[model samples]
Target: MAKIPKVPKTVLPKPPRQAVPPPPPYVPLRARPVRPQRTNLPNQQSPPHPSAQETPIAPPGTTRSDRLKQVWDERPRVSDIKRLTPEQLSAPTHQNRMNKWRQWTLFICGMSAFGMGLYGMQIYVSLTTAPDENAVPDDLSDRFDKEADGYDEKVSMAETMLFLNSRRKALMQKVRGHVLEVAVGTGRNTPYYPTKQCATVTLLDSSAPMLEVAKRKWKETHMEYFSRVFFKHQSAVDPITPPYGAQDGYDTVVQTMGLCSTNEPVKLLHSLEAATKEEDGQILLLEHGKSHYEWLNSFLDRTAPNHALTHGCWWNKDIGKIVEESGLEVVDMKRYNFGTTWWVELKPRKGMRKQLEDAAKEEVEVAVQKSWSWWSFWR
Candidate 1:
């Protein structure tokens, strides 16, 4: 083991050096020939092919004519562009624009109509349920006064003013001696009264609050005529008997937008006739009546029960017949707004001054006639 370890101390052979290849030599580029300068002319242009000097020469045995022929066959030729007809050019744009405008207009009109219909429906619902004496308690008078004071703010006062103004002059001229204004709400028409021509006006209303408001307004505005104006808180049916007294009967009784809500229009008319001096007194009425148009009448008839329930007013009362049956003569009846309303002037017939007394006496006769008719029917 000792002799083998001593023999291993030998030197290794040295490694050989590797050779690296040298980089290729750089050559200087030859200068190219300069092309002739071009003139700044609009019609002048260079050919699309390369110059002869810049092109490579073909090797021996190559055909140059075949390449030139192939290039010529591949070129595009110039041709005229076709034009559109005059009608075709103009029609499409104009028609498309018009159609778009028409569609927009129709859409806007339909929206407007729908909005108007909704507004009308709301108004119908509101007016049909408007409070009146027959339906509401006595406390409603205060509510009505509060409501009416704010009517302009709640509703369109401009339209209401215009409608009231239209009737002002007419009503003022028609008033005469012992004039009574029935259901004079807030007295919008009070300013229009002819104080000088009319001897006295008894403003009658069932609503004490409304009467109070009317009196206050009258005193505030026409304090001078306060003595001539009398405000009575009473129902329309409270019999024109003593204490109230019918000694000096009314000469002209006027009602505007009042009769429609009267609980018993016929009875009221008869009572009015009883309260008036024969032939001298008159009843002037301006009322919106049942429409004469078939469709409108049908609609009104259908809705009348609901209207009456809400408004405390009847829409289909035969007012003309009521006046006639009350022994009053219709002096004039004029239809307005396509027979949707009437301006009626009536008076007690001559010799019918004692109509109430006569009616009282004839009660037995009417009863006897009814009894006879019933007996005859059975026979």
Candidate 2:
């Protein structure tokens, strides 16, 4: 047992020493405490910020003066805008004076030419057209018969020049329900009638030829409404009988330029009044008469004789006065073209229609009595 213990003690080797990490490299302690270096984790670096001293980079090839000018132009200003007055805009100048002078000269020349042409036209018509001493109220039928063929063509230019078609349209647009158009020459107002509004339209004219022309026009323009229209070859001065369906009275009585042709305009208006519904019936008249101006009236008066001889129209008559004398209530009245053209809307007075009817009835009774007496005497 002694030999075994000595042998184990001699065989054991010395143990190896363990390694120690070096102390962190010497970092000198700062006099003032300094911020410790930030320890960044993997892939977590921050971007650098711009400094206040940075300047804007100019565009290539642009001058400093050019850049300054661009900045100046883009800057906003409140006082740059201005508005000019009419006086400043229309300041007198040589060119402006010349233009005004030329305009005035042309206007005067044009007016003079118009006057001369009007005088010449009157002369030409008076000389060319045959005048009949009998072409008064009773013989107007004959005169119109002769004039019917070329009448529309003869008057179209004057009507257009005066814009008379528009005036007729304005007047006829007011017509509604059962309508009676007296002195419907060639049916110039035919196309303007609202066919859907009028239940019946009676066209009355003195001349058979004129009625025929009106019939043809109505057929051509409003053939679908044929059943609604009727033509009467009779004078307006005579009592107007309502068409077959409208036996009571016409809703509207229209006469354009007729007062100028009739010998007794007031009588014509009275007849119209008699033919309309007493309560709500309207009488529409578009006529040419003495102008408001005395100078124009004098001109019309001077030319009236020849004009009447040629056209059988006494255009110098005072239509307003005639309407007033007819005793109809004036609803609306307007004048155009220096008061020579008139548009009148009138309503029948309450008892005026009855008075006219009684007078007419008495006259008819007297005529029948006279005829009976004459027949008895012959027997």
Candidate 3:
């Protein structure tokens, strides 16, 4: 509604045009289509395609050779590539005669070593076999006493087969504080005992002759370790009570390859449990029995008679089953060498003594409450 004013317009200059690039020259399936010469045959007149005359111009910064390679790669099948022959494809990269000979030589050496080991084991097992059943420790003791000097050597011969020394070493290394080695035959386990960490050791045995050899073994190597070492004349089934006082029960009880021949193995186990401190005392055992494999078990069964008779070892004893029946809490149990060999650690059950007493009392009560009856026939 008020006065309207006219505004002046300013114009800007347009930019100048430069030369435009031409479209890239036509490219064919092949880099070069054959061109016809002036004197060529009648139908091939002066190259049929006008593109032949077109002369390709490569993009800036690229040579004609690079353009040629791009077209070449686009082709589905490359005519210039060489194919492999069947003979070359089948040839192994590492099939020299020297390699073949080396492989065969290694195989032969391995088999020879295996055969030699087997031969040595057969001789060793035969030598360690006891001459009679271990019905009496005195009988076994008498035999062992005569062989005491040669005993260590005989066992050494079977180390690889039976793993006797290794098992003893492992069992003894674990024992500490006041310790007990029951059925401490020849003191074979003393060599590995952790006596430096322990206060005292009590070596107990029923067989006097075996004790004598064990005593000699102690005097030889372990003489300086113990503050006090007692040699007790006792059986495996006997309780660790009386004269020694606090040293009677132990922190660890070690038994290796010894329980397999006892007259009453489970009874011995019960007695061993009672002899240890009920709160924390442990038992370490490495024992063998019938192998799980049918063939091996059968062989053991066949050999068990003469084996027990001569070696005083019952080869077919099921050590695992016996330990379970012994009422000790097996904290850890491992089997090796075809389920025949067992490495077990057991602790005293919380109320073992009470359980045995209760069982006995129940048995007596049942016997007294019994009502006699000649039984009526199927009425």
Candidate 4:
């Protein structure tokens, strides 16, 4: 084994030490020079820096949360309220227009309130006061006679309001073949009847004066079709014979505003059915009655007694119920004015009833035959 030679040890010289400077002389905080703080004049404010505008600088000692509260508290108080002068008030600017609108609104509100008050008072009086024995006539026909002379004039306003002439036109346009118009008051529907479509038009009413007015109206408007028009003075509930032209039966029987005045509306409807042909005859009716809504129905019921005395109509009658009880089949039915006004087309159900009975009889016969066959097999 060879012995390893030892490496010679090398020594490096050390660098000289540098001098250390003495610490700064101590000075008391109170002895230090004070910097002058910049302040804005009372009337003049300094322009905000661009950075400060985005992020506001808080006071030296204030915390972030306290800075927000302090900023809110130091905010300047200013009012934007303004008063208008007479010139500005009367000017035709937006504000002036707004004022006018407000005035009109107030006027309308006041007028509506006044009207409502009057209506409420009327309802109260009608409900509270005992009706006089002589207030209404026992024979309502007499009331019609008395009103016949001015009947057209009296109802013109309401007719216009309700657009009844348009309704009459619509109904009369549907009239075909021989026509019978019951409760013809002042012939309001006469002008609307199609001369060519109707083979004959018979006007029937209980009130003689009303009949006279109807005749006059027919003579005035439909004199050209005088041969086709006839006037009959009788109650609608009375048994009516078919006119000379319509020997089988009236093809169309029309009654407008009639059921309201009648004591026996169901009887009237039945009588109308009897007068009409059983196969193809139609009964057309336009009437005002109890509304679908209970509130309106209540108003009608509350006002009915007094209204009947003056108008000779029980306005609260359930026209639908009356028609249902009459046993006539409704062909078409429509309502307007919140279901208070009804336009109905009805036909006799005799043919339908016979058909149903025949069908039932055939079914019974088939069942009986089946049972007899089963018994025979068992035997």
Most TM-score-accurate candidate: 2
List pairs with backbone clashes in candidate 3.
130-310, 130-311, 131-309, 131-310, 132-309, 132-310, 133-309
**What TM-score would each prediction reach against the true structure?**
0.54, 0.65, 0.58, 0.60
Tens digit per residue, CA lDDT, model 2, 291-342: 9899889767666766776576887889888887887899999999999999
- Sorted by TM-score (best first), the order is 2, 4, 3, 1
**In model 1, which regions exceed 4 Å deviation?**
1-119, 123-164, 241-246, 357-379
Misplaced by over 4 Å in model 4 are: 1-138, 351-379
How do the residues 205-313 of candidate 3 rate in per-residue lDDT, one tens digit apiece? 7767778888888888777864478888877775555235544367788887778757688988887776676777888888888677888887776667555555566
In TM-score terms, candidate 4 sits at: 0.60
lDDT of each: 0.64, 0.79, 0.70, 0.79
TM-score comparison, 2 vs 3, better candidate: 2
Residue range 1-379, candidate 1, lDDT tens digits: 4655555667988888778789866643333444755667778964322231344444577678977775455343222112535574355444454456568779988976776786578558755665443544323234344555653343344334335456655866888777787777667677788788877778887777667778888898788888888888886654453223336578877876566667567767776666676757888887766766887776566566555554444565555666666666788987655565667888876665475657745875787877785558677
Pairs clashing within candidate 1: none
Question: Which residue pairs of candidate 2 clash?
Answer: none
- The stretch of ten residues in a row with the least summed lDDT in candidate 4 is 47-56
